[model samples]
Target chain A: MSPETTVTFHTPSTLDEAFALLKEHGDDARVIAGGTALVVMMKQSLVVVDHLVSLASIPGLVGIDVREGAVHIGALTRHRDVETSPIVREHLPFLSDVYGRVATVRIRNSATVGGGLAHADPSQDPPAALMVLDARVRLVSPRGEREVAVAEMFRDYYETVLRSDELIAEVIVPIPSATARTAYLKFLPRNEDDYATVAVAALAEVANGTVQKLRVTLIAAGPTPVRAEAVEAALEGQSPTAEAIRAAADLVADAVDPMDDFRGAPDYKRDMAVVFTRRALERVLLAQG
Target chain B: MQLNVNGRTLEAEATGLATLVDVLRYELDLTGTKEACGVGVCGACTVLLDGRMVASCITLAAQAQGAQIQTIEGLGDRELLDPLQESFITDGGFQCGICTPGQLMAAKALLEHNPQPTEDEIKHWMMGNLCRCTGYYQIIESVANAANAARGDR
Candidate 1:
């Protein structure tokens, strides 16, 4: 750790000011919202930056409201706010379930939605559900803003497609169909709040016992959140019978690209991903019929 | 940086890099809040920033500016301990006592938000604050008892 060097901090009240700071510092600056992940890295000297721009004071970046047909969560909105938010629960309960499972109430209370996505922790819980929910993250910079689907946001481990000067402004999740049933199942061997060894998040629509629509995503199965494209395709129009679901669940094994770690061996995680994916599908499918 | 801590405005020097726990313990000398794990996993550094319980170790002092931060030192009055504190003592909530301050602050935030929190609620809310010695039943009891005392049901 560089004990001698101290970072310069700026609390900007507006997005323009914050963007200007990021533009000025460019690669040397890092935007911190909730600081749950960034500060820990900073403390460990893993991330050494000359300037720290805090988004906490930005008023426009702190809210959970409905916009159009989706729920718009400001980048700086804390996880706890999202978890307990009546709007979030009512609009997208899958999102609330995912956010509620992160770490604990204390970590959730401080970790911001934008910050969590920006941090790009693959093992974290939110991204998987956000991916299944077809959420889009808004990234703003001095130039302008652009939206990236949650599935396409992450580039690698602890990395995102976000440019150095860009800040995550908001997350927009289109509300699911009123009849769609969603399930988020996180396999945690240690404790309830611990990071999932392997987690499955899925939403399914059943029309006359046929798979009308399905979206599936996996966590801790790869460097980035893994969208189970194969599984989704397998069950899209098939009858959601146990036989069909079992065949679809097997596809998750190949779709996931996990690595060996404390959680499990890569093969073990892949296997568990298949099991949990099947479990999640069963839960959602059962909820319908 | 200037902060409204525990209902009193105080000035503290914090580098842009300093965390809220850092400024509170080192600069402001509010050592009641302890930093056990540098990460957000441990609840030892829990503090209330604008009435919301957050991990002080990860929260930047700069981000917490213009907000009210309450630590363990601010929980009780000069004359007597807060009812929560009294409950902790009477219910045998502490053994090592290292986690007491953070636990107290977390409990305070919980009760303020959800007065009369059920046992399930208390367990869920206080999950992050680890009490290595107390095995948690006592801490849960302490919070429930304190909630009861707050409502004058004790």
Candidate 2:
């Protein structure tokens, strides 16, 4: 049993108070919402913090709303909440589908969207889905508030651009066009609590039986979730035929630099990426039809 | 530190970093919440925090301060067990009973949210709580039984 350490648990009622607590504790503090990831890290001695600022008690930080053509998900909103939110389900069905496949329902009931992003795991499903959606994250500190593109928020493995005195306030995703369709696919060793071997999120607009615009993002294949530019480029101005989809999928596999791990070899992941990408694109095209 | 455990609020002199699992078992003498794995991977230390299931072993005691927490003890007693607890006993949901408390709590929360869940939904919801003793067939049956029992009561 690890010996208990002296720590302060600060519960803030508002965003301002939360930022103040973060500013006071700085590097010595860690913000906890669900504690699903951070707590395990603390127990393993991977992270040691003197202060834990609780974000669960904060108001207006646990909801999913649509405003001004953008979907705003509060930072403290639980994964389960987002998975079942009508707004998210109707507007971002791909995200809801990915959320349903995350960890487990119990963890999802406690795990927050911000914690998942703040943890910055390369293989996580939300970052991939959000990246393809071109989401923006709002950060609050004692100084003020600022927004950063989700694609730029990740610096490297288990690293984020958030300062110690900053807390992610919310994630904003612009509503997709009416002609657009999206899909997400995650390949895992098993179905439950298993990290993704390779996850893909694809969004495309089909205009008059041809692909007008496309965006594909791959997760868990590198240090950060990467946009599959080659695949997107290949899909542009092409029909949603099987041949075109296969060519785009091949481009994605060739573009990613996946590492070999205990779960799967690099070649296996690359193959699965191609296969899953084609399947996801097929599903989206069928839905559009 | 003070926390509302099971139902009645109690106070204890402990550090803020002490996990709720340690505080309940060691300090408050509520050893029902078992700690199979200190890590949150194994949900054997699950408890309800304001009607939501969370792994207590990973939750700090200070985090529970002034919050309503429900352990297995709060569900029922020997005299009158909750329907879910009764269903577990009737359906043979446990082979060793080591993971019973966590399983019961998780099932209880699932049924609370969704009074009638399909078999797939139950399995998906209960994935966090592991049971190596049983192949999880009986556990799923136990939750189904509990759901039926709750519906019958209504």
Number of the top candidate by lDDT? 1
TM-score per prediction, in order, is 0.96, 0.94
What are the Cα lDDT values of the candidates? 0.88, 0.85
lDDT of 2 by residue, B82-125 (tens): 98889888888998998999999999898888989899889888
lDDT of 1 by residue, A126-214 (tens): 99999988999998888899999999999999899998778888999999899889899889886766778999999988888788899
Candidate 1: list runs displaced more than 4 Å.
A1-5, A287-289
A1-289 per-residue lDDT for model 2 (tens digits): 3354777778889888877777777788888988878887787788888888899888888899999999999999999889999999998887888888888776787789999999998878898888888899999887889999998898888899998777898999998898788888777766557889888888888889888878888888878887888888887888888888888788877767788887688899888888888887887765555
Give per-residue lDDT, candidate 2, residue A99.
Answer: 84
Cα displacement (Å) at residue A61, model 1:
1.6
Task: Please report the candidate that would top TM-score against the real structure.
Answer: 1
Clashes of each: 0, 0
